[model samples]
Target: MKKSYRIKKDVEFQKVFKQGASFANRQLVIYYLHKNDQPHFRIGLSVSKKVGNAVERNQIKRYIRQAFTELQCEIKNEYDMIIIARKPVKACNYHEVRRSVEHLLFKTKLLNK
Candidate 1:
């Protein structure tokens, strides 16, 4: 994903957490805030150390980014989103990760149906 499409700042993530609408499933939680000022979607992933060691956390984040990349075109634009992965997510493969992410996005109505 491009830099413009990734939410990179602490403040931005905080804003989403505080003001965005949220949804969740067993594996993931999604928080989204609509931004009429922007023309693209920005996403951030949160995988804590509780999920695993550095390697496992990085792997999960990579899978999430890949999933988000694939789903980007179908996602509604002009939103800032945060995806939080639970510890169980570390056990998931890419396909599982993608499915869980997609499921949460749909539940949140972030993906355009």
Candidate 2:
């Protein structure tokens, strides 16, 4: 994901965690907060050490990023989003990761149809 599209600061993630509405499935949890001033989307991903060692964690993050990239056009702007990987995600593959991400987004009811 591009720097411009990612939520990089600790403050940003904390804000989303504290104030955003959330949705989750077995593999992913998504939090989102709408904003009128931003006019763009900011995505933050959290794949913790508990999910696996470094390689597995990085691979899962990559899969989630790719899934978000594919769905970028279909998602509305002006929102801050945080995606957290669940423990079961350690054993999954790309397609499954993508499906999990998409499923969580759908549950949010904020994605463009």
Candidate 3:
């Protein structure tokens, strides 16, 4: 993911956490806030130590970023989103992560038909 498309600051993440709406499945949780001025969506990812070691966590992050990249056109613009990975995600493959992400976006009404 490009730097411009990512939520990199602590304050930004905190803002989304405090003010955004969220949806989740067993694998991932999504926190999103509408940003009317933004021309496109930005995302932040979080994977805890409990999920796995560094290698596994990085792999999960990569899968999530790839999923977002592929789904960019279908996802709504003007939102800041944060994806939090849960323990179960360590057992999932890329396809499963993509599906989980797509499902959460659909549940949050952020995915366009």
Candidate 4:
């Protein structure tokens, strides 16, 4: 994942949380807000402490990031995305996590045909 294209600022995360529309599934929650002229789709990931300890949380975040990075090219332009991991995601393997994210993105119409 490219650092330059990631949602690194606190304000960006907060804005998305406050204003973006959300899509929820068993494994993840996706929050998205359209941007007028974004350079690329920027993503933020959140895994709560309720999901696990630091190690488990980091693992979940890593899996989410990896899936997003792999799918970035297929995603459309001018959108900010935030993916929130659920508890089930921690126990899930790579393919499961990938599919969950992909499914949500597809359902959200972020991926072009």
Best by TM-score: 3
For candidate 3, the per-residue lDDT at 96 reads 95
Candidate 1: clashing pairs of residues? none
lDDT for position 80 in model 4? 96
The window of 10 residues in a row where model 3 has the poorest summed lDDT is 1-10
Candidate 1 stretches with Cα past 4 Å from truth are: none
Write model 2 residue lDDT over 3-68, tens digit each, in one string: 799999999999998998988889888989988888678899899888899989889889988998
Candidate No. with top lDDT: 3
Best of the two (3, 4) by lDDT: 3
What stretches of model 3 exceed 4 Å from their correct place? none
- How many residue-pair clashes does candidate 4 contain? 0
TM values, all candidates:
0.96, 0.95, 0.98, 0.94
Question: Where in model 4 is the C-alpha error above 4 Å?
Answer: none
Query: Per-residue alpha-carbon lDDT of model 3 for 1-113, expressed as tens digits?
Result: 68899999999999999999998899999999999999999999999999999999999999999999999999999999999999999999999999999999999999988
The C-alpha lDDT values of all candidates are 0.90, 0.88, 0.96, 0.89
Tens-digit lDDT track for model 1 on 4-95? 89988999999999998998888888999999999989998888888899999999999999998999889999899999999789778999
Error of 2 at 36 (Å): 1.1
**Residue 82, candidate 1: C-alpha displacement in angstroms:** 0.5
